[model samples]
Target: MAQCASCYFVFCLYCRMVYHGVQPCRLRPGEQRAIRDEYLSATPAAKQAMEKRYGRRTLQLLVDESLTQDWMQENSKKCPHCAISIEKQDGCNKMTCWRCGTYFCWICLVALKASGNPYQHFSDPRSSCFNKLFEGAEELAEDDHEFRRVLVRALPHLSHRSRPRLCLA
Candidate 1:
């Protein structure tokens, strides 16, 4: 909370809007996005200022949440049956949900649990993902060389007991 010395108007310091005690600010959605963007692009000194204003943990949590949401959107899709998020590492479109064991098409997101032959959906001429069972595999394969080079470069120092965990962050 803050008060304008001249106008004597009261407002929330975070949102810069009229104070509403104990209730969340009305400017949250857009305001929060703007703040997040600003914080991400800010310099170390400016980031410290933001951390001082918003608290270090709060700002870190916001940034972590934003990054996680973006990575999930880019790399994962939800199961149509159980709605659980599934990441397709490398394979055909046929995906089995780890949680519910529901078979599904990774490309079309249609449940394949009812079908006797799930691969038939890919072979059918009328299907959207027809002849696309190996869809996106070519791109992944192209990157395999670079990925292998990185792994090979790191292999010299890596030991079975001392290998570091992989982290995308």
Candidate 2:
């Protein structure tokens, strides 16, 4: 038995069909649909168990990609130093870019001087982002909830056994 490099689906080299563990392969359309429906309706814990049993890393990558795309759509800021997109999950407007270590204000998108106190930007009335750290906390929370809902909808597709073939060869 060997695993497909692209999809990670195990198969017998000689038989050229998916390995169904110890059971016979159930490739009938009705059986497949029933299994898919069961998985889709499963609880989060059950889905997690399925991910662990099948392909945890793949499922995680899919979830991360979906979340990143959603974040990019909802939040409109890129890290000044690294150019990587960022979303302010919560807290004050002060943001530290995880990729480039650049400290910036989430609201004004200004890079804060490393030599001075970061909170000074918030306190200074002259700064555009002054006293605006928690400006949209409630709205950000609601956006987060929507993101999670989108992730949950995507999980079923990620966990499906019959996902599209990743490689032609």
Candidate 3:
């Protein structure tokens, strides 16, 4: 939430609408990405102008969050119960959320706590992920391998930077 000094109108920074108490903003799609891209490519003068409009610290935080969110969306899945990003380093499709400890199916993002045997979902005829428990396992393993390689290569240079080097490969 932020306030305009001239108008005294308080609003969400992401949605640019009147502030709502404790509710998530319904921000326009690609809005954050647009801002981040512009900021990243902006000239020093343009960046200064942006910082003047949006505080330097706020803008930096927004850019960082946008970058992190982008990376997370690509590399991880949100826990069904807690919504915390969870990456599968090496495992089966069944996952337990670290934060909430809710058992879930990684492929379908369905909470499996209600099911006595979580793995049964994969064999259940009516389930979406039925017969596909280890779907895309090979592809994901290759991608994770590439990501680890990229991260190892980027680690030295990343120490000097404020943001982690994204492994887009």
Number of the predicted model whose TM-score against the real structure is largest: 1
- Tens digits of per-residue lDDT, candidate 3, 1-169, equal 8999999999977668888755554435567677668878999999987776556765776775676577788889999988999998776788888998898998879999554787888999999898888877788878887877866664553334454646555
> All models: lDDT?
0.76, 0.67, 0.77
lDDT of 3: 0.77
Which runs in model 1 stand beyond 4 Å of their true positions? Answer: 2-11, 16-30, 141-169
lDDT of 2 by residue, 17-76 (tens): 777564433334344444445455789998776564445554444445454555576776
Residue pairs in clash, model 3: none
Going through the candidates in order, what is the number of backbone clashes in each? 0, 1, 0
Best by lDDT: 3
lDDT of 2: 0.67
Tell me the spans in candidate 2 whose CA falls farther than 4 Å from its real position. 1-71, 158-169
What ranking emerges by TM-score with the best candidate at the front?
1, 3, 2
Model 1, C-alpha of 167: deviation from truth (Å): 8.7
Lowest lDDT block of 10, candidate 1: 155-164
Model 1: lDDT of residue 70: 69
